[model samples]
Target: MLNLLQIEFHKMRYNRATKIFLIIYFCLFFSITLFSSIRFNLGEINFQLAEQGIFNFPYIWHFNTYFAAILKIFLALVVISMISTEYSNQTLKQNLIDGLSKKEFILSKFYMIIALSLASTILIFLVSLGLGLIFSDFNEINIIFSEMGYLGTYFLKLVAFFSFCLFLGVWIKRSAFVIGALFVWWVAEGIIKGILTFRKQKYGIKDQISQFFPLEAMNNLIKEPLTKLGIVKSSIGVVNDVNIYWYQILIALIWTFIFVWGAYFLIKKRDL
Candidate 1:
């Protein structure tokens, strides 16, 4: 298992696609930070009423949720392609035929995915902290650390989401199909959910159908106020109001296990 993991890590590190994605990721990271810092410096962006403290929670939440969310999507696509390309290129079969257990093969990919997700979250957090320092007059380090409790939940969400994407890729065995399905799901789901909620409220059936969507459960981790369901508030609030930290974590883990196991089962049972 250790050897397989090492091999997987090496492949991830050396892959040209991964290198290009990392370069793009870093470029976007710096660009977003610079833009935010410039806005803050120009007094064009005021996240807090008092400029003496670290920027308010809303700024961090917005930056993380919107900016980091795009990176997560690209990362998921790369992960899906990593495994799917191997399957498509017949390299996965070659690896398995070379004496590697099917279990090791699948688990190595899972470990690599999880490791990459954690690394992505950490890098985002560090960027947020560094940008916070550049733009805020307060003790940015302390404020960044204060909000760092959500890092674990964010990591879990990314893992769960990406694992599901990988499972789709493995089950479908086509990179284009996986990417298309993901794009449709990500784009259409929100619109469909809004329509459903609007229609359901008229008929008083809102609670019966909301939980069926995976995105709803997964999004509980980020707790975006605009996307939140149930209990509408009249006042503007910067903090996350959801108390489902443990529940979100649990849901993420359950989904991750299901997808990972599903991928393993498909890889083991299907003809290469």
Candidate 2:
């Protein structure tokens, strides 16, 4: 496994584009700290994000993970380009010629996917922990640790999404087409969901069936946390919401397996 990872590491090491994208991804990841300093003053309407208690314990776990998940697109560029560049540069063919098995190649890419997802999860966990400790009113250990399952959800979110991107990168072998494929797939899922939701009203179809879609499943893993803000809560009172759903995680796992296996199946069947 180390050898496989090292092989991939060296492939990316000298690529200037890979280096730039990775550095930018982490830089953007760390920039979430700046939200704590956000302030707005418009005439009598003075607002501060810090005072909103977004950084509060337990809640911070949810808030930070939700926010961090938005930044996946930046890292996604790395994953897509990683494979696309291999085909564009003839490296994929060269690697096979040099006696690296098809399975080993896929394993290298999958391992890197796991590593990147784990690293992002760890960074977000630390950032959330630090901000919560400094700002949360509830200091008890139980309160501090509660809702940490968001870290797991966040990790699963990235791995599943990145695996899909990796599969598209291999299947299409072009960066632009892969991105376009993602957009088209997202739109298709939305349309199908809308239709299914409509059918639920008339034909007694289950709305939960929409949750089986790849992107929707991944989205269902983590919900928006904006409604949890202090001001919103004060004004609207408590809203009934579940931050994480087990079914969403299971759906995402199924999709991740399908995508990774699909990518391998494609490579194995291709004449290259």
Candidate 3:
């Protein structure tokens, strides 16, 4: 596995698009962290968020994780571009022709996905720790660690999303079409959830059902802090309350498995 991952990394090391996207990805991610933390530290944000300790010790984990997760799409685009470029360049076929088995080839890509996801998670963790230590007024260590679950949730969500992206990349083999489908899927989920939310009271549709939607289920792993934004109800234009369900983690893992299994099936069954 290590040798396979090394080969994958070598491929990425020479890919200009992968490097460019990574640069853009980290820049946007850190910019968000800095801007949000600085504004809150300077008392420039809305009173509601300020009162909620948006950048404070314990809550800093949640705030940073959520914002950092926003950058996952950039990583997904990089993954898609990398995979699709291989198809375009016939590198995947060359590797197999050079004696790499089909399973190893696909597993190498999955290893890359896991590594990238972990790297992103670690970046978020470091930034959150730095920001919390610098500006947080709390001195208790327990408070700083209390909301750490969000970090894990953020990691799982990234893995799940990227797994789906991997499946898309292999199945479509076209970066543009795969990315477009991703956008449509995201928007479609929001639209479907919105419609279901609108008819919730009439049909007794529960909020939990929305979590079953692939993206929605991954996102639901981290419930929005009610006091931070206070816009969940306002934006949704519904009075429905969202609670953090622990099982959503399990649901996300299941979806991740299915998506990865789908990728494996497609890669193994299809001609390279």
Which candidate's TM-score is highest?
A: 2
TM-score of each: 0.81, 0.92, 0.88
Q: Model 3, range 129-188, lDDT digits (tens) per residue?
A: 887787777958888888688878888988899989998999999999999999999999
For model 2, give the 10-residue run with minimal summed lDDT. 239-248
Candidate closer to the true structure by lDDT (higher is better), 1 or 2: 2
Say which candidate scores most in lDDT.
2
The lDDT of each candidate is 0.70, 0.88, 0.82
For residues 1-272, write the lDDT of model 2, one tens digit per residue.
99999998888889898889889888887776765656778999988776678888888888888888988998899899999998999888999999999989999999988988999999998888887787787889999998888999999999999999999999999999999999999999999999988999899977878888888888878887877776777787977475566777888999999999999999999987
- Sorted on TM-score, highest at the top, how do the candidates line up? 2, 3, 1
Could you give me the TM-score of model 3 versus the true structure?
0.88
Q: What does candidate 1's lDDT look like per residue over 53-170, in tens digits?
A: 3244434644364447656766776788788888778988898888877788888888888788878887877776665665555554455466555666777778888888878888
Distance from true position, residue 224, model 3, in Å? 2.0
Q: Which 10 residues in a row give candidate 1 its minimum summed lDDT?
A: 225-234
lDDT score for residue 67 of model 2: 82
